[model samples]
Target: MAHKNQFQLLASRRFLPFFLTQFLGAFNDNVFKSALMVMIAFRLAADQANALNNLAAGLFILPFFLFSATAGQLADKYDKAFLIRRIKLAEIGISLVGVVALISGSNTLCLAVLFLLGVQSAFFGPIKYAILPQHLRKTELVGGNALVEMATFVAILGGTIVGTILSGASDSGGGSEWIGGLIIAIAIVGYLVCRVIPDAAPPVPDLKIDLNPVRQTAHVLREVAKTPAIFYAIVGISWFWLLGAAYLTQIPSFGKNVLGGDEPLVALLLCSFTIGVAIGSLLCERLSGGRIELGLVPLGAAGLTYGGIALSVIGGNLAPLEEVSLAAFWGSPGAQMFLFHLALIGVFGGLYIVPLYAMIQERTAKALRARVIAVTNIMNSLFMVVSAVLGIVFLSLLDFSIPQFFMVIALMNAAVAIFVFSKVPEFAMRLLVWLLSHTMYRVRHEGLEQIPAEGPAIIACNHVSYVDALLLAGAVRRPIRFIMYKPIYEIPVLHFIFRTGRAIPICSRQKDPEGYARAFEEIEQGLKDGDLLCIFPEGQLTKDGEMQPFKAGIEKILQKTPVPVIPMALRGLWGSFFSHKDGHAFTTWPKRFWSSVSVVAGKPLDADTAKSDHLHQVVLGLRGERL
Candidate 1:
């Protein structure tokens, strides 16, 4: 059965076993790690406990740095389902060792177990993401990713709480044996759950394994550098992890120092952020209409910045109290606002990350997908470590207050977003298209599925307004290269989008013969490169709310590059502000706001029969008096 929403995947065998395995694994890891940290804190001296906690954290992250490259090779060389089962079995053995360590009170053994768990996680990391595309359809990618992200954060929150509670119970005269049993039970169950996962055959089964971590990691990084879009996506994902880690690490301190709240209040803060992320992650599928929407990335960035700035301002306004209770903290100035901003950051964070992950998985070559994921994991580890170091420098050495540090991080986020988006203008162009489609008009697409999913094709449409290209861009899933009149292509802000979208600008032969030739050269190159190209068959916008006669430019295009042509029409745009209805385009006030518009596409027509007149008739019939 087809799934309408991400949650429905939970009920299907194709996804359920894998989802449970991933969720259980993350849950078990955090449970053990949190329990270990809590146990050390309560049992050892304050200084000793602090040192061991830091050591434990370092141990967990070290495996990714050391073994990730090798692990990526293994994932690419073997069935992921088989690897996952083996990894889960190893987790059971590790948990058995952890049980003995916890009950025997051996700090060294506990740290060793932590390191082993990290190793297990490192090996599983690449397979976890790489397997999704093997199982899910292209349309389901975003939803699948959203569900996974939501589950992961939820697992973190749930596991942390459970571990903390179990550790506290032990401190209150409960025996350590209970914690041990629970850990062993979780590991065993995880193994059982993973056993049923469907086999994911390796993409590069014949590839030789590289045993050296340094050489393999360097090699992988070089491969990743070849695709700048995927590389920057990895950077963007890593930066997000850094940002998230910074906020999570500081929250407890923020609660106690800034708000003068207790452990309970700190937990509440954590809940706010985690729950918000869960909501936002789930919302991604809905917001993007189940597609990997790049537009949401910029929106998420904006929300994160706003949330951070608001938090800093609210935090600066608060007065620290002496041991404030949760109830009293709620009554204190800015408490509600503080929590809201934290949650907002998390919500936008979810919006920011899901699409990026889906994009990486979809765009990367299948043979190298796992290794690319491995590179991202390594970068994530490094960025998180850097975040910790920077935290120390800002809050300790630089003597910046918590609020000021927050402000600095927010500004850094802005700067980083600008750098990434500017480097890849597709993101910025998507943002503009998404905003225009969502705000200025309500666009309904018809027969869009007729557009080819891959390969080169031409789209000949009736151009009703200057914004028709933007609307079409948003409506179609694949990116399009527009062939537009030079004057319209050069509209200030719109020019940035068109140029970034690699649009071709042309003038009449009499006006500029050289420019006209260059435009056709670009068009031919674009088609040769397997790009989707769109042209306004009418040549220009209509002077009235009526169909304009199709021009010969499309015929010229087809003569040179005979791709299948899809006739399209835009309705309800003729009288809009961007159209020349009562006066020249954009010269008069808008006739309406959030007006209804429709983009109707027809089935592909053979290049030989798709003459200008025939295509114009088809588009007009499709439009069907809507204007």
Candidate 2:
């Protein structure tokens, strides 16, 4: 049975083992990387340490660009469970080599181990996401992704803290042995946990492997481009990483130069951001009501902008202090605000990324999912590289203050978000619908599962308010093509959503025969194209919070394209802000916020039996005096 709470998945055999395996792998990677960074800082000259650190970062990221294509192919062509086991086994060997290098005090060998670990991670990345849809139900995708994201950030923080502590407690090379031991132990445990992961059969067992990275990368990019939604989702996801990298890379400097703080203050700032991201990520499942809610993406993106700007402002206004401890820094003016905005950035970031990941997995074809994810990985790597270079250009070359650089990033994020939302209005449309249903009304859905997951179906619902279509769009899992009245469809602001959503706008035959004919023609084509369509069979909103008689237009539709008709109803929307209870929608103040509302879907009826009067009664019964 699927768990209602995402946390409950931790107790399930299907998810727990796999989750642990990945968690351990991430933890181990960070522990090793952080320890190595600290060791270099302590033992080497400043310039040498800096150069090696940059090299380490680049080496770790290099594998994603070089091996992601082959990794994607391998993941699709083999059982994911088996591949995970072998990968974990390789990790064990790599950890042993790392131990030997640490014991010998060889930085060269240590860097080599880091590069090898990067290769291991690159191979694991494709399998990490591709296996999700195979193991999880559609309802659990958002929750699963939420948990993964939360675990990832938490693990990173924990590993960084632990590694720093371990290194700090030792002199010179003493911490190296402990780090090596911990890494090896984690790798072994990861292998053992992965052994229990349920089998995920290969999606394309006979697919040929493409060893040519350049050629395969081009191929996979082309494949992702075939689906504009998936491509844009990848782009959005990549942009998020770029934004995140900028914040993470600059935090230490922001603390030292901007806040005039020491290591403890840096740790505090990191904690604020990391914890915020964890909180935000966990909230995704709840805020989305356990669905892949794309609306959160825009909300997150906007929050990031606000948070970044807030941080920049706060940082710019701060008076400088010299080598202050965490406590001293906390006493600084604007310190609390800085931390809050940092956390806010993380929170919104969580809201932004989880849905995009779930959407990619849900939409991509199984045969090509891994390869597409590989392309995503490549994009992420490319973006991170660009982010690093931009950081240099902005701060180092241009002599811009960290606060100024942050403002640049925030404005850049805003621009990217606007461009993406314009190209993919579905994100913006969903955001509007989500806001309307979540803020203006407390929407409860009933029998929504009656709507087929994939098929051509007609939804005939009573129109109680002007915003009924938007409310229904928010409630339903599938994308819906609303057949809207022309005037309502042409309403400003709403018109963008309606048009972008591909709502078919119709007028009375006497008003505009051509438009009416065109609307029907579009409806026929939409159904033939296998879209889930919704029509307000009442033809217009009720004047007195009552159902209007269903129009014959639905019957005409069925005669031309006979498909299943699912009777649906909107209840308790009367006297609400969008309703006509007080003259007209938006003409008067809303009597209350979060008004109780319900959307009910009745069992499907064969098109032949779904007459106008019958659907009206069915909808009326479903509403059941709730208005």
* C-alpha lDDT score of every prediction, in listed order: 0.89, 0.90
Stretches off by above 4 angstroms in model 1 are 218-226
Q: Give me the displacement of residue 69 in model 2, in angstroms.
A: 2.1
Using TM-score, give the best candidate's number.
2
Please provide, for model 1 over 282-331, each residue's C-alpha lDDT reduced to its tens digit, 9 standing for 90 to 100.
Answer: 99999877878889998998898889899889989988865478878888
TM-score, cand. 2 = 0.95
Candidate 1: pairs in clash: none
Give me the displacement of residue 149 in model 1, in angstroms: 1.2
Worst 10 residues of 1 by lDDT: 171-180
Range of the 10 consecutive residues with the lowest summed lDDT in candidate 2 = 167-176
Error of 2 at 73 (Å): 2.3
